[model samples]
Target: MSLHCPSPATMPPADLPAPAPHTPIEDLQALITGCLFVALSILMLRESRLLTGGTTGLSFLIHYLSGWRLGLVMFLVNLPFYAFGLAALGKRFTFKTFCAVGTLSLFTELIPGLVHFDRLDPVFAAVMGGLLAGIGILILMRHGASLGGSGVLAIYLQKTRGWRAGSVQMSVDVLILSLGLLVISPGEVGLSILSAAALNLVIGINHRPDRYFGF
Candidate 1:
């Protein structure tokens, strides 16, 4: 007797349907990962006395001026954008974004106790922090959420006008970084621009609509 096994050419075709958007469990995992990375990025920026772009950068500016808690400032700064998010993006998207923002706020506050940095190079911090933040935001975007603030506007414009979210974000970021000249030194502002460029490069390259299929 001879035994027969199916060879690759004889097997069924491997074509498969596109995957459905993330389930709740997967979304939760993404949220956790995104928040942790963002928190770490913020910590690196803080340690290095650097700032990136967007509303988070505004929070940093406020924190520097007022000596308030960065996490709290960031959370409050993001609150006003929820209305726009709800109106333009819908209830589900806005709700998920709210949760993501809250998680990030809490994580930023708690991370200091969990992680410590004895020494960090400013240039290294700027580049790494920007990259991590860009990746974290990408995760949030893929999971149907955002970090709020200008992110809401970016998504809204993308959906309504076909503008790229990353490009929109980069424009806003450059404006915010320009404002940094009032508070931070010109050299620091230059570093912030570099960091923002790195962050936006990630978004521009990877966050395009054609690149990702998930909601």
Candidate 2:
């Protein structure tokens, strides 16, 4: 008779615990907080007459050019993307995205009345606004929601082609900001680029698919 035991070096590694699934209540809380942060960022940018990137930036440009409400323009701009979201991301993702977009639209409209900034420096606005928006977007992404527009496209591309969403978004934003050069001052364009970098850096660092498995 012989007894055998596996050596410590040959022992199998233990499995890591899976992340907990998000509850409906957790999703609702994240949605509200995310929208609030994004709305606040938009308010700061509006006050400073600064532009950002993505569909939100496009909304700001339209608002400046047409004197339309930013919230209304943002909501409208995101509408066309829902079809793509539904087709590519399925029902639950699209529904959460729709809720997120609608909540952001309403919050952007309402925040103006609740908060007022007498003087906002362009540099401060650009940096802080970008950070806040990035955090908001991170929260949305973790919960499987998005702000729509290019975000939908980014997610679709990432899923289909194994691309990084942050990289996709940054490329689109660069093009959009280039167009912004025609309407906004060159100085503001530079600041807008800085803001875009800040926003994308957050996504690039924290939103990697390999690292985050919640969504």
Report the number of the highest-TM-score candidate.
Answer: 2
In model 2, what are the clashing residue pairs, if there are any? none
Model 1 C-alpha RMSD vs. true structure (Å) is 10.5
lDDT of 1 by residue, 79-158 (tens): 98888788677898789888988999999899988988888887888888888888888788777777888867776777
* Pairs with backbone N, CA or C atoms under 3 Å apart (clashes), candidate 1: none
Candidate 2 on 72-139: residue-level lDDT in tens?
Answer: 89999989988878876889888988898899999999999999998889999998888888888888
The whole-model C-alpha lDDT of candidate 1 against the native structure comes to: 0.77
lDDT of 2: 0.79
lDDT, each prediction: 0.77, 0.79
lDDT score for residue 84 of model 1:
73
Ten contiguous residues with the weakest lDDT in model 2 = 1-10
